[model samples]
Target chain A: MLKCNNINVKNILCDVSFEVKRGSFTSIIGKNGSGKTTLANCIASQRKYGGSISLGNTSMLDISPCDRARIMAYLPQSLPSPNISVYDLVTLGRSPHTSLGAKLNKSDIESIDNALAVTGMTMLSNRMVPSLSGGEKQRAFLAMTLAQNTDILLLDEPTAHMDMHVAAEFTELLNRLGKTLIVIMHDLSLAIKYADNVLILDSGKQIFFGSKKDLLVTDTIEKNFNVRKIENDGEIIFTV
Target chain B: MKKLIIIFTPLLCISIILGCAFGSADIMQLIGNDTDTALIIILNLRLPRVIAAVLCGIGLSVSGVLLQCVTGNTLAAPNIIGVNSGAGFCCIVMLTFFPKASVLLQIGAFAGAFITTLVIVGIASHINAFRGTVILAGIAITAVLNACISFLSLLDSDVLTAYNAFSVGGLAGIRMSQLYVPAIIITGCLLCSLILSRRIQLLCLGDAIAASLGVSISKLRIACIILASASAAAVVSFAGLLGFVGLVVPHMARRISGERTSKLLITSSMIGAILVILADLFGRIILAPTEIPVGIIMALIGAPFFFILLFKRRGDNAEM
Candidate 1:
């Protein structure tokens, strides 16, 4: 389990607390300027924060960078199309586990292959990342993160560059991966549909944190996001 | 990549032979003559010129590769980014004021290069400038340093002979004694950079991604800058601000070696050595006894390459 207790980032986030169960998909939903990325950065240990964030018994801050990378992988929204082949880029994910001069062994190669296969990028493994389309580039980066083989994945707006259909497909892929995920999502309906639990942030405050079913019945999201949630033909949708 | 190394290795050896053999006095003919003047010309002058070419080539190219990777700017080379000019300015000052203390020239050059690199990077980062802006900022810094160099040269007419030869950057009068310290420093820095190539490659992925992959971004960048400064400063101390080897050779190496930093470093070092030796040879033979400077030839080639790169990449991220 990952727990955040009264996490604060000066004026950005204030006393936001939550607990994420292992192997659960938790979607963090918030409007613009709601400090979602800041919270994600704090959990990724990329930024300083007040209060405590722990993984099981140990504090997250105490974990060495290599160990933390081994256990949790974080991907930011803005990705660079580096001029390297997809295979080489995915190979970088094994850095935390490998030594300076060590070559790729059987296990590392297998992990890279599996990541490419899982992301449907196996055919494009030899292609340069800079030549890839936006959605394909996102998949390539996703493959790199998956190759990391971490227990928890923290993504901030991972689908920002993708079209709606591709984004939906990508979300479905993430939903089936069965890893613990804390994703900051902008799409309300997608967040409501696939997330096992939801955390709502409004103006840097934790307005709600509960199971998806419980969240759907409450007015917390609608009040903060200024949107109405409706059910039609057993399908959930949000209208602004 | 293997083909690249194979092709360049022989080319480099041939260039080395040509550079040592056919200077103004034809050192090869003196091999069996057993004359003291011939031996002095061959061993003391021509041989050191060849050695200086190789060392400066490797030093500048490795420095270029490191700067480009760390800054994520394709145009970030020692010459283009004010590092060479800064070192040149300091070396000129050292030669003018403390002519008796020539041993301290490398230290002064390293201090100057290090400070210039930090200042350029600091100002760029402080304003949150993009990659192209960094190059522009470097060019501006280079202009200021060059002006300072010019002012010093004007103030002391005695500094002109050394300053004129040094400013245009040639291998005409290099002695074997000048090559020893710089050779050691360049070799050491190259080894260290090769060993750290893997971590350095991660830097091209950008800070957030590299940090997430367990590499300390700031620490690694600082280490690379120090290495680059040391190598470039060492070269400027002996070779007199030779430009464009750092800028051009890495680009060629990348074409052959792909994006792997280790492979790029090895290929770049070999290719860089070949480029300088051949350029020096051409400078010797192009105008016969007149002998144009190696820096002028490099500028003739590199200025066009830079413009082509700039215009060809105009719509890409590098242009911005």
Candidate 2:
């Protein structure tokens, strides 16, 4: 389990507390400047916070960056399009595991190959990162994070650049990955579809944290995002 | 990459041998008649010049690679971005006022280079400027530093002759005493850069990702700046603000060796050595007794390459 207690980032995020069970999917939904990314960054130890985060029983502050990276991986929103082959980019994910001056072992190669396959980017492995399309680039970076083979994945707006269909497809891929995940998303319908639990924030304050169904029943969606939640044919939809 | 290195290594060896064998003295003719003169010319004059070229080449190229990676700007090279000017300005100050403090030259140059780099970086970060803005800032600072250097030379006419030779940046009258310390410093820094190559590559991934991947972004960037400054300062101490090897050679190496830092550094060092030695040879032979500065030849080459890169990036943006 991943637990965050009273997480606060000066001016950006206020005191927020939550716990994520292992092998569960949690979606963070909020308006612009609502501190979704900041919260995720705090949990990933990418930012300073006046709180404690622990993975399992060990305090996150006690773990070295290399050890923390082995347990959790983070994918930030603004991805760079570097001029490197997809395979080489993904190979970087194995850095924390491999010893200094040591080559990748057979198992490491398998992990890389597996990550590429999981993201459905096996064929594009040889393509340059700058040449990949928007959704393809997203998957390439996802492949990198997945290759990290960590227990918890923190992704901030992973589908922000994708079209509707592509976003849905990518969300389905994330849902099927079977890892503990905390993803900040803008698309409410997709978040409701894939996430078992929902955490809503408004202007840096945590408004609600519960199951998606319970969140839809309340007026939190309407109050926070200015959208009305409806259910039809066993499908959840949010219309602005 | 191996093939690129293989082809270039031999070419570099030949350039070095030829650079040492042929010069203003025509050592070949003197070898039969006066062995002492031949030996003296080869050992005292030609050898030191060739070694200076090699050292400056490797040092500047490696330093460029480090700066480019740290700044995340391909146009960030030592000379083009005010690093060499920083060192040159300090050197002039030392030569003009504290001529007796020869032992402090290297340290002073490093301090100058490091301070200038920090200033440029500070301005860039403060404004949150883009990559091109950083290069423009560097160019602007370089012009101001150059003007200061010229003004200093005007005030102290006694330092003008020494500063003139230094300003044009040629290998005309090099000596063994000038090269020994820089050679060791360059070699040591090069090895450190190579060992940190993997971590440096991670830096290209951007700050957040690199930090998330266990690399200390601030520490790594600081380390890179220090290493790059030391290398550029060592070269500037001897070679008199040699340009272009840092800017041009790394780009050439990247084309041949891909974006891998180790391969890029290795290829850049070799290609830089060959290009500098050959440029020095060309400068020596082209004007015969007049001796064109290698800096001029490099400027002729580098300025055009810089424009090509600029337009090429614009073209790529257009394509995208």
Q: Per-prediction TM-score of chain B?
A: 0.86, 0.87
| Clash pairs detected, candidate 1 | none
Q: How accurate is candidate 2 locally (lDDT)?
A: 0.85
For residues A1-240, could you state the per-residue lDDT of candidate 1 as single tens digits? 999999999888999999999999999999888899999999999899999999999999999888999999999988887678999999988888888767889999999999999999999999998899888888898889888889999998888878889889989999988899999999988888888899988889898988999988778778888898898899898989
Model 1 alpha-carbon miss at residue B190, Å: 2.0
The DockQ figures for the candidates are: 0.58, 0.59
Error of 1 at B309 (Å): 1.9
- lDDT per residue for candidate 1 within B245-267, as digits (tens), equals 89888887876777788888899
TM-score of chain A of each: 0.98, 0.98
Task: Sort candidate 2 into its docking category.
Answer: medium
Q: Stretches of candidate 1 above 4 Å error?
A: A228-233, B26-43, B80-82, B102-107, B114-151, B317-320
lDDT per residue for candidate 2 within A115-217, as digits (tens), equals 9999999999999998999999999999999988999999999999999999999999998999999999999999888998999888899999998779777
